[model samples]
Target chain A: QQQVKQSPQSLIVQKGGISIINCAYENTAFDYFPWYQQFPGKGPALLIAIRPDVSEKKEGRFTISFNKSAKQFSLHIMDSQPGDSATYFCAPYRDNAGNMLTFGGGTRLMVKP
Target chain B: NAGVTQTPKFRVLKTGQSMTLLCAQDMNHEYMYWYRQDPGMGLRLIHYSVGEGTTAKGEVPDGYNVSRLKKQNFLLGLESAAPSQTSVYFCASRSNREGQGALGRANVLTFGAGSRLTVL
Candidate 1:
C-alpha cells in the first residue's frame, strides 16, 4: 500500500507565479517530513523540512506548510523561477526507523520564463 | 569534499548477469542507504546499513543485497540482473550523531549523483 500520496503529477507555472505541491501521509509513525528536489541527471537533494510540532517552516522562497492533525503537508515556492523547474518529492520519515524515508509519487514542476 | 560518491554512473547489463554498485561517503556518517528511483514512482529504499558490518532490508529489498564492510563504504550487489531492475539508483548517508531534537536536521539525507543501470 502507498503510505504517502501526492497530487498533480505535473505542474506548469509562470516565472513570477507561485508553485504549490501537496502530500498526504497515512503513517502515524512518521515524525520528520522533508521535501527533496531533483534535477535531471542528478540525485534528489534536501530542499526543506518540517516536524509535526510546527505548522509551517520557510526557507528563502521555499515554505513548508504542515498540518499535523490532517496528516498533510504542502510545499510552496514563491516567485517560482525557471531554475526551480524540477521534480519534487515528499518523503516522510521516522527517526527510530533508522531514518528510513517513504517517498511520495513525485511532482514534476515546470516554470516558464 | 565528496559527501557521497557512486561509481559507474551508468551501466548496461544483460539478464542474469551480476554486478555491484559501490557507494562511498567522506562525511564520516554512520548510516548509509540504497534507493531506486523510477518515473512517477518517486524513490524506494532497497536496503540500508546503520553501521559497519550491519545491514537491513528496506521496503523493496528483494533481488538485492547490500554489505557495509567499512565505515565509509556501502556496496549493493545484484545476484542476477533483471529488466525490472533497470532504474536510477541513489546512495544517501546521514550522521547518527546528529542533534537529538525532534526538529533537528538529523533526518536530512545527502544523496549522490546516482547510478543509472539498464538491463536488457
Candidate 2:
C-alpha cells in the first residue's frame, strides 16, 4: 500500500549545493522518521532521524525538517559533496504489529563536483 | 566489535533448492532483523527476533523461515528458491535502552554489508 512515499526517483546536485529529499507518510501512527544512506554493495546506514514532537532537528551539516500535520519530512544536506552520491531511503517507524519499519522506495542522489 | 555479520556474502541456487543464511552479532543485541533489498523496492523485512527462542514474521515472510536459537545468531532459511527470491539480504541488530520506552525502539540498527543471492 506504500505507507511512505518519496519524491524524485533520482537527484543531481552540484557540489557545495543543497541536497534535499522529501517523504510523506499516510499513517498518523508513525512517530519516528529516519533517513538512511546506502552505498553500492553495502547496507543502508543511519544518517539522521527526527521525532514528530520536533519540527526540525539538525545534526552537523545534516538536518531533518518534519511536519506532523502534513505527515511529511525532508532531509537536507548542506554542502553536498561528491562522496555523497548514493542511494537515500526515508523510513517511518510504526510499532503496531511488531517492531517493524516502513520504508520508501528510495532516491538516488548524485552530487557532481 | 564485528557488529552484525552475515555468512556466505554471495550465493547462487536453482529452483527448488534450499539454503540457510546465518547472521551473528557480537554486540549482544536483543533484537535481530532480516531484510531484503530489491532493485526498486527498498528494504523489506522478512523476519525478526526480539530475543532468543522467539521469532516473528515481517512484511514478506512467505517461502521463508527464521530461527533464533541463540541470542547472538539468527538464521533465515528458504525452503524453495525462486527467481523472485533474488535480492540482497541484510541483517541488523539493536539493543534496548531506557527512555526508548519500549523494546526495539530508540535504537539505531547496525547493519551488515549484505548478502547477494541469485536464483536460477
TM values, all candidates: 0.93, 0.90
Task: Give a tens-digit lDDT track for model 1, residues A27-95.
Answer: 887878889999999989989988787899999999999998899999999999999999999988775
| Candidate 2 similarity to native, TM-score | 0.90
The CA lDDT at A75 in model 2 is: 92
lDDT of 2 by residue, A1-113 (tens): 43788977899999999999999999887766889899999989988887777788888888999989888999998999999999999988743333766578899999999
lDDT measured at residue B18 in model 2 versus the true structure, 0 to 100: 100
The candidate that wins on lDDT is 1
Interface RMSD of 2: 4.1
Per-residue lDDT tens digits of candidate 1, residues B82-105? 999999999999877644665547
Candidate 1 vs. truth: CA RMSD? 1.8
